[model samples]
Target: TKRYYHERVLDHYNNPRNIGSFDKKAIDVGTATVGAPACGDVMKIQIKVKDNIVVDVCFKTFGCGSAIASSSLATEWVKGKTLDECLEIKNTDIAKHLSLPPVKMHCSMLAEQAIKRAIYDYKVKHEKLNNSETTTIETIASL
Candidate 1:
């Protein structure tokens, strides 16, 4: 029988740091949405970037203790990392940190995917702004 790691998760869940809302105008990337009902979890992860590095991150999670812990850990992992490094944070990493049971593994997956989606949303918007400017310049040059 496996010993419960509830305390591990609780520690993070109860003392989650970097928990707060961010200003959309200052954030390099922002994403918020509900996850699948079948999974019984939802998370919103936002990262603020400066010079291609994540200067801050925050998350609001609803689900099992493991899910909350994963979100808490993910927030810690992403902050102060480059976007590329943040993208590398995996579900397994969170699970390992919390010593989560196999059955609860999906919770970490939800957290991981949610973080990636937020980053993806931010990257898409960043690219669009850059592309728009490039297009405008090209058009003017062709005139």
Candidate 2:
């Protein structure tokens, strides 16, 4: 069945932002890959952290337009946010921002999962790389 999509979602789908991947192995980079098995949607969200802030974020999504738009907007919202601030990002917010319907809300949830996972991954890397230098975020999805 067809469903309605918000204009902002269409805009994002048409002109996705930060649509790329980063080197996952980079000390300052955290990569999280998530997927929705039911829909065959896969999303990877990667982030670069400096001083516990998300300086940059990138994403690659292999899914429907909603998933792509959700991820694209997620990247835009996460950039320039502190790790804690990023943590505050919610799927509901993404849904509201894009005006997504209940059925499509999972796409936003995917984005949220990707963001948190990436942050956690970054924290792990940060702990390890504390003694090392810093650098740069990819496909991320959620169920």
Candidate 3:
């Protein structure tokens, strides 16, 4: 007997949108790619920024249906959100959205971690740019 939740999972698996990587130039905000060979899973996530908000997102994931669904839902949720807003997203929310089985709950956790890693990468790059500009200004002022 097929369950309703299983049907939903199949829906995402059969037709996952935004399912590929964006070019480095296209991703203004951040990106992260990770893999687990033991589990034969890989995940890639990228965010596009406009006015400091996440205007777009894309992901490529190789894994079970739950993993794909979690990644797909996460990308959708992160779009139109600020960095701070992205941080507020949680694994529980993703799992709840898909009604994920308990055994597969960890997939959502992985998706959440991927999002955090991407956001952190963005912050680090932004700070480095700002610091370099500040240092140049200071040196010019001292001359």
Candidate 4:
């Protein structure tokens, strides 16, 4: 049986939006790369967060149409959402949005994982920054 892709999927693949990387060194930026080479799918997602909200996002995917579409859709959905809201974006939702087949379901899963990984990185960096600031303040008070 031949399968057809959803229009949204085809649109995303044909003209993928936010298909590039950002400056990783930026304080507000977070990036994550995830994939299995054996599966022939690699996806990298980057996010810029402000005040606990995702203000921007981008992705680069090296894979099939499904993988590209999934990542593209993920980036679009995550922008303008809070970190917690972004976490709520599930693989199932992505699959449904793209009308992905069971075989391509893993592509959506990869997108979700990428988002989570980026957010985790952002939180870790901010935590370290906060801790450093606190230590500096304590040191100043003791002087």
- Compared with the true structure, all predictions reach lDDT values of 0.74, 0.85, 0.76, 0.86
lDDT of 3 by residue, 19-127 (tens): 8776755437588776655576878888877777988889989888888888888988998888778878988988888889887777887788778777656655666
Best by TM-score: 2
Q: Residues 44-118, candidate 2, lDDT per residue (tens digit)?
A: 999998888889889999998889999999999999989878878999999999988888988899999998888
Deviating ranges (above 4 Å) for candidate 2: 1-3, 128-143
Cα lDDT of candidate 3 equals: 0.76
| lDDT by residue (tens digit), candidate 4, 1-143 | 55588888999999998988999888899888888555878999999999999998999999989999999999999999998799789999999989999988989988988888888778767774467545643442332
User: Can you tell me which runs of candidate 1 are displaced by over 4 Å?
Assistant: 1-3, 24-27, 32-36, 128-143
Q: Sort by lDDT, best first: what order? A: 4, 2, 3, 1
lDDT of each residue in 3-115, candidate 1, tens digit only: 56667797887898677767655547566444646676887778887788887788888777788888888888888888778768889988988889899888887777766
Instruction: Score every model by TM-score.
Output: 0.79, 0.86, 0.79, 0.85
Task: Please give the distance, in angstroms, between residue 117's alpha carbon in candidate 1 and its true position after superposition.
Answer: 1.0
For residue 7, give model 4's deviation from the true position in Å: 1.6
Pick out the ten consecutive residues of candidate 1 with the lowest summed lDDT: 134-143
- The per-residue C-alpha lDDT of model 3 at residue 47 equals 83
TM-score of 2: 0.86
Per candidate, the number of residue pairs that clash is: 0, 13, 0, 0
Location of the lowest summed lDDT over 10 successive residues in candidate 3: 134-143
